[model samples]
Each structure stands twice: as structure tokens, then as C-alpha cells.
Target: MSASPRARRMTGAQAGAVTARILSAAVGGYALAYAATAFLSVYLPMERPDRVSFASLASFFVWVATILYVFAARSAWRATWVPLALSLLLGLAAFLPGGYGVRP
Candidate 1:
């Protein structure tokens, strides 16, 4: 079936595949940062990542990618949806300046 504009742009199966890609990418990115932090922590704790630019940016991208990929899989990916919803709620609050949090 064709995807509805209001409905996600991907089919359920496609969504699942996309989620896998997103997860893999996220894991790879995190591992890279983790290794960087591990090596750098020895010389500088603050520079390790919690407040650094690249760390925060990577985290933000990971979050966005996860959300998009997960939500796209909502049709057949019931198992992956709960976390997506929670993330959406938190994202709503965090973004949009002072916008209200998402309601269930």
C-alpha cells in the first residue's frame, strides 16, 4: 500500500529496516565518542564530552534519527514505539523554546 501523507512516509516493513539502520548508526557514533572520551579522559575530564560541542551534537542527531526511524515503523513496530513516544514527549518539551510537553 502507498504511504499516506499523514501516515509515515515508509511502509511498516521499510520502517523496521530503517530503524535497524538508525540503531546501527547510533551505536557506531556512540562507540566512536566513547573511545574518544576514554582516551581523552586521561588528559582532560571536561573535554571528554558531557559538555563538548561534538558530543552534544552527536547525541542530538542520534535522538532525532531514532525518533524519525522509530516513528516511521509504528505500524508493525509496536515493540519499538513506547520508547519513541517517550522521546517525543521529552523532545516536545526540550524543543520549541517554552512549548508545552506532548500529551498522550
Candidate 2:
């Protein structure tokens, strides 16, 4: 269903907020998962330190920054080019590299 007439018009600012919210949720989930993985790598006994997933913690930090995107998306936040770009770059850096993956 289309939006109501009253809701028909959405300014760029308003749209940005909604986008931010969605991004926030997605990034937050990523961060949590990364953190959990990183936690196990650090405290858990590891026979080989070389097997540690070094990138996982860095990925967590990048994902955490997505909160700004989420905030902008959910609450009609203005569309800022810099934050969006940063988020994308960070996401790629964190997700594209296999530096964070560890397998049994």
C-alpha cells in the first residue's frame, strides 16, 4: 500500500533517518556477532596464537559506528555524505577481508 496523502511527501532528511534505522539494526547485529567471536578468541585457550582472528575486533568497531546511520534512518536525520561513505568503506573493510574468519 502506498503511503497516505499526508505521508506521501517525504523530505530527503526524513528518508535518511529511516535508512539509518535499518542500517543501524543491521550493523548492530554484525557488531554483536563479531564481539562474541572476538571474545572467544582472546580469553579462550588457543593452542596457536597465530590462529587468532585479528580482524574480528576491528570489524566490531567499524560496525558499531553504523549507529549514526541507523539514527539518521529512523528519525528523519539529514542525509550526510561523509557518514554514509565512511560506513560503506568500513563495512567493506570489515566484511570483505577474510582476516576475521577462523575455522576449527
Expressed as tens digits, the lDDT of each residue in 1-104 for candidate 2 is 87777776778976766666665457554654455445444444555463255545545554656444445452433334434555455445544454657333
Per-candidate Cα lDDT values, in order, are: 0.48, 0.51
| Model 1 residue 37 CA deviation in Å | 0.9
Clash pairs (backbone) in predicted model 1: none
In lDDT terms, how accurate is model 2? 0.51
Q: Summing lDDT over every window of 10 consecutive residues in candidate 1, give the lowest-scoring window.
A: 35-44
Best by TM-score: 2
C-alpha TM-score for every candidate: 0.28, 0.34
Give the least accurate 10-residue stretch of model 2, judged by summed lDDT: 74-83
Residue-pair clashes per candidate, as listed? Answer: 0, 9
